[model samples]
Target: MTATYAEHSARKRRPLFRRRSAIPGFAVTMGVTITILSLIVLIPLTAVALKAAQQSSSEFLNAAFNERALMAYRLSFGAAFIAATINGVFGLLTAWALVRYEFPLKSLVNGLIDLPFALPTAVAGIALATLYAPNGWIGALVAPAKVAYTPLGVVVALTFIGLPFVVRTLEPVMRDLAADVEEAAASLGASRFDVIARVILPALGPAWLTGFALAFARAVGEYGSVIFIAGNMPYKSEIAPLLIIIELEQYDYAGAATIAVVMLVVSFAMLFVINAVQAWARRLSA
Candidate 1:
């Protein structure tokens, strides 16, 4: 009987919960997780939704989709998309270079990639505004092109803040990608471009998309860094967050909430689509 029982135990799958776990059980862990999530995220979002719901449909639409609001949305989303795309391309190159080669000041450059994350957004905005102002060094060199106090400045700021997201996301994946795969592809008579397209890009697509989505989302909500450079001109360089602040300044709480809800929904929808695409890419790569 003992021999038979031992054989059966060995063949059985391991249970998720061990008889003697060091940590708490599933029920306690799940309860704590849910409670924390509710406190940090769900509760505030629910409040925003409820506040927006106080307004009638017409009022909500008027505040959320006004002409100025629409323009702000366009500028914010457009600049964010452009910046995220730029980051995706250059970030991939940066990651590849960092991983595949060694150069002077490599560590310094790698450390600098995370500067945007550690730097305060307001300080970043101020610094960028100063550097890109018409009389500033870089701005003077550009001559005829204006950067600060323009929509282009918004893109510049967004790109600056978003680059770290893409670079950090790609670096680990790039490092994990074995050189053997590329050599194998080359050995199979594939061209350099073919090796990249066939082996590297396919492996990196999902992660790239995830990084792009994160950058886009971050750029869309960015305020302090953009405002100084953007000049915050109405219907021109103004962003959605600035618009929300404007509404709030006038003590239009419901209107502000309505705009917030619109932004929330749009951001959520875009993220959902990006996540779906990422999932599709993963399946295709698999």
Candidate 2:
């Protein structure tokens, strides 16, 4: 009877809202995360928006859509998109080779994949310019066609920096894929191309899209590496970030803010679309 009374008392003591979690301090952790994000990301973005808002609508439009600014936007977004696309294809191939094959100096090759990440952007720009300049070794091979100090150079620099994003994002996904799945598909009379297209690619679609988005985002804001190679020619190879710096230098804070707001909006829109595609891919794979 005492034991039965103790059980009843214990049940009564339990709170209605009490629920256990695998990780403790959920409320505290969430609060900390929100605070950090606000400090690091949201607040700065808000400040930019506020600064842009200070401008009259016509002034903002004039600053953002001026002929030179439009050209810069074209160069920036166009080069970034092209570079990311190239990386998407070649990066997948590179990741596949690293995961599935054995080759000479395999460890060294794997390590070298991360070189871009560690190399400073300015250093990378200088190195690329040296190698691709008309007088340089590789540049001599393509002497007739200008590479360095052209928009092509901007694309090359962006591609170099963005490659690692796609490769790194896809590597773990490829590593975890089961060889048996491919073999089984073969046994069912699937051709090699078909197997890759139908089985492997579908499974990797979400991750591939994620990598592409990351590469695009990184390339969009790239400045340090591109300036050395791009020649900074207005309405030609000039990129948006350089234009922003030029505005800042000229003490056109409102103009700079307007350009920044445009970039932010476009980048956010592209990311949103990519995320939607990733979600669709996930659903299809599942």
Candidate 3:
């Protein structure tokens, strides 16, 4: 009997020792991940760099930094920055309202927040252009403001698409925040403004930065939606991506590559700085 019991116990222990994880081994998984990343991301970026390098340094500089390119860059980066700032402020308010308050049609409103994501960029552009045309409904209401076919319209289009990034990034963080903390602050004689400024903002600072960075990045690369509204006027409302397409259309691949390289470098640098700041904020909040 003792031998029988011992054999059964050993069978159970053997299965425990023999069981394997469902995932592949780390080496295999890591190798596959690196191979995929190289194929999809690294190789294309390298090709772009090499293509741009085909041009002489002066040629590259002229292509990337000429009057037309500079104007386009200014508009693209400036509009993206402004749009991201707007999204950051209003996205916070929207997320806060969703998480902290009860309202009629709450579910419908929450669902609508993701409308931009499901909507195609071209469709969104056309819809926005029609709605904001000087003769259109909302445009007629704000007559003489000149929304569509201007730099302002570019900002508006960017803000429309980028808002979802900020709001979604903030929603999870806002939900994680405990109401007890606010109650505790209130019970201790802190006013509503004081509670928000001192208690809520600190906890959300990192997430806010992350959301702002995401929105800015999305807006920087936007093309289809912005082109429809911006009117693509050179030195006026043209954006950097539009310049890239124009270069391609003119059969100036090297010039297009140079412009792309410049945008890529600037965008990467900005995102790196934003991420660093986000990390610092996280450390401080911790």
Candidate 4:
């Protein structure tokens, strides 16, 4: 009877999580995390909301949806989407190469992958502009096509900044993939294309989507890297973040906040959709 009672007490004492975690003080850690996030993220967003509330509905609509603002939105989101898509494809290839078969100076190439992350946006923009400008080296090669000081320049800048996100995100997943599964598939007469398309792609789909989403999000708010190459023509290559800066410079605080709020809402919706897709992919894989 005593043993039965002891067993019941021990069972009740067991942690809800079956495995013991290396980290301790879950409640304290959770509280700290919430506090930090509130101070850093939630508080600023709340401030933006409060500032935007100062504007009347008509004023907000006029500021956010004016012809110039609309054009800026189109350019910004369009360039970001295009850049992220480019990154998704090339980044996957880069990650695969880094993981599978390394060549000469492979370590140098790996280090270079993170160059954009360490380089200042302004510096990167200037370098890209210099390299792609009509009179510049690479620019001379594609001179008639016209890259710098155009929407194409904006796309190039965005692609430069966004590439690392996709490459880094996919690298670990590629490294962890089981080689035996690939070998087994090949031994069963699966073509290389079939192995990549039917076996490898499905496994990496969620991570690829996550990387694409992150790249898109990062590109959407990019300012410094874009301005130098974009030329910032109001109705043409002007981006939304540049528009916000213009509003701020003109002391149109409410207008800036409204634009920011709109961007926040749209970005949130996009990220939410991406997250839903990722969740669906995870379920399918499982």
Candidate 5:
């Protein structure tokens, strides 16, 4: 009786959520994670900044802001933005269909969407270049459209690379969403479009923005596939990352770093804005 009473007393003393392990183990995990991140990310980033610091601020600006570099920047950001926008619109529809509809080969279709993730960037670029080039098999048909070796080709390459980010981001969110909300809307005489526009889209706002941000960032850094199709035409098809590589090859490390810093800053700002939009969306949902 006394032992059972003691056991009961112990149970009563335990908190609702007791610690499974009292060992202070996050210290090692934190140290290792931080060290790995610093080595891979912070160290390299710091090196770029340090190399650029070797030059005068005006020199760095002049090198990175020259007409060629500026044109590359324009092409890179412009193509990425257009690609991300396209991904956002179509990815949402794809996610909706996967979650809310059933059809033959649905699983196969889902698998195909992720093929880009497994394919080598070099291989993807080569294939796209061949597919879209003026006189190649598929290109022979489309060359009339003048799609390859032009700015349009860069957008296509970026769009191909960024599609998975959007679809994957929205898929889980759509799956976990309760059918009751839509049901409730329908029950209250709300049309399908109204339910989706007012009830669903608002809930999905943050995740959609997050997906767009990811796609945007990924597209901005893309080089392999774009290089093959872009023709690297100065001021026309060259992208910012390729321009930075050119600067580095020419022994202009400071110029490359300056451009790198600009890309980093702009990407960071974009991600920050996305995060803010997410916060606002959460508040709205609440």
Candidate 6:
């Protein structure tokens, strides 16, 4: 019943992950993480539902479906979706350009993609407002530039804020897809369009959608940036979050909660759909 020196050394040299049982440390770590997330995120979300439930169904419906609330929801969701869609198409191209081909200033272009992340939202809002204003630089170059106090301004603000999400999401995916599959497609006499449509587009679809979803979600919740550009006019250009703030300022806590709950429900539904798509995509890839 004596173990050989080599056998003993081999046992000692085994990787930490190669143990007979999974690490108790991992379970403890995961438990703590899940608990913290629930407390920080899920608990507050539950509180919103509970508070909204305090009102009768009719009251909640009235608050959420009012003229001002309706306008805000339309503008906010509409602008966010538009911005995210634009970002999705252009971000995919940017990701591909950066990953698939090398050109001058590639590193600089990559760094610029993260500029939105580094820039504060309020500052970005102000800067965009100034640039797109009637008399401002970019505005002057293009025709009339009433962009500062318009719904178009809101879309621009959201797009500016959301661009980084799409770019960052697609970048790594593009990097992984480059060269090998492309070369294989090329060697098989596939045209550029054929390779992209067949071998590349399908692969990029899920990640692209995930990025679009992220950008849309970020845009929908945006307050700081959109407020400056959106003009915050009631029944006109105001967004849902801004409208919620208005209700809160007017001491209409129930009203605010009602609108918040609506935003919460819709946002959850959209993000859930996106997540399901992402999961389906991962399954397809696997």
| Pick by TM-score: 2 or 5, better one | 2
Model 2 segments more than 4 A misplaced:
1-24
**Per-residue lDDT of model 1, residues 84-166, tens digit only:** 99999999999889999999999999999999999999999999999999999999999689999999999999999999899
| Candidate models: Cα lDDT each | 0.94, 0.95, 0.94, 0.95, 0.91, 0.87
| TM-score list, all predictions | 0.94, 0.93, 0.92, 0.94, 0.90, 0.88
Query: What is the C-alpha lDDT profile of model 4 across 1-286, one tens digit per residue?
Result: 9999999999999987888678868898999999999999999999998999998889989998999999998999999999999999999999999999969999999999999999999999999999999998999999699999999999999999999999999999998898998999999999999998888999999999999999999999999999999999999999999999999999999999999998999999999999999999988877
* lDDT rank order: 2, 4, 3, 1, 5, 6
Model 1 residue 111 lDDT? 97
lDDT per residue, candidate 3, 223-270, as tens digits? 989988899999999999999999999999999999999999999999
- Ten residues in sequence with the least summed lDDT for candidate 2: 15-24
Backbone clash pairs for candidate 1 read: none
State, as a TM-score between 0 and 1, how close model 1 is to the true structure.
Answer: 0.94
At residue 59, candidate 1 shows an lDDT of: 91
Per-residue lDDT value at 69 in model 1: 93
Give the CA lDDT, 0 to 100, for residue 215 in model 2.
97
Q: For residues 1-286, write the lDDT of model 5, one tens digit per residue.
A: 9999999999999898956776558998799899999999999999988888889978988987889988998999999999999999999999899989999999999999998899999899999988888887877986578778899999999999999999999988898889998999999999999998899999888889989999999999999989999899998999999998998899888889999988988888888988898899989977
All-Cα superposition RMSD per candidate: 2.6, 3.5, 4.2, 2.8, 3.8, 4.1
Judged by lDDT against the true structure, how good is candidate 2?
A: 0.95
How many angstroms is residue 91 displaced in model 3 relative to the true structure, after the best TM-score fit?
0.7
* Global Cα lDDT for candidate 1: 0.94
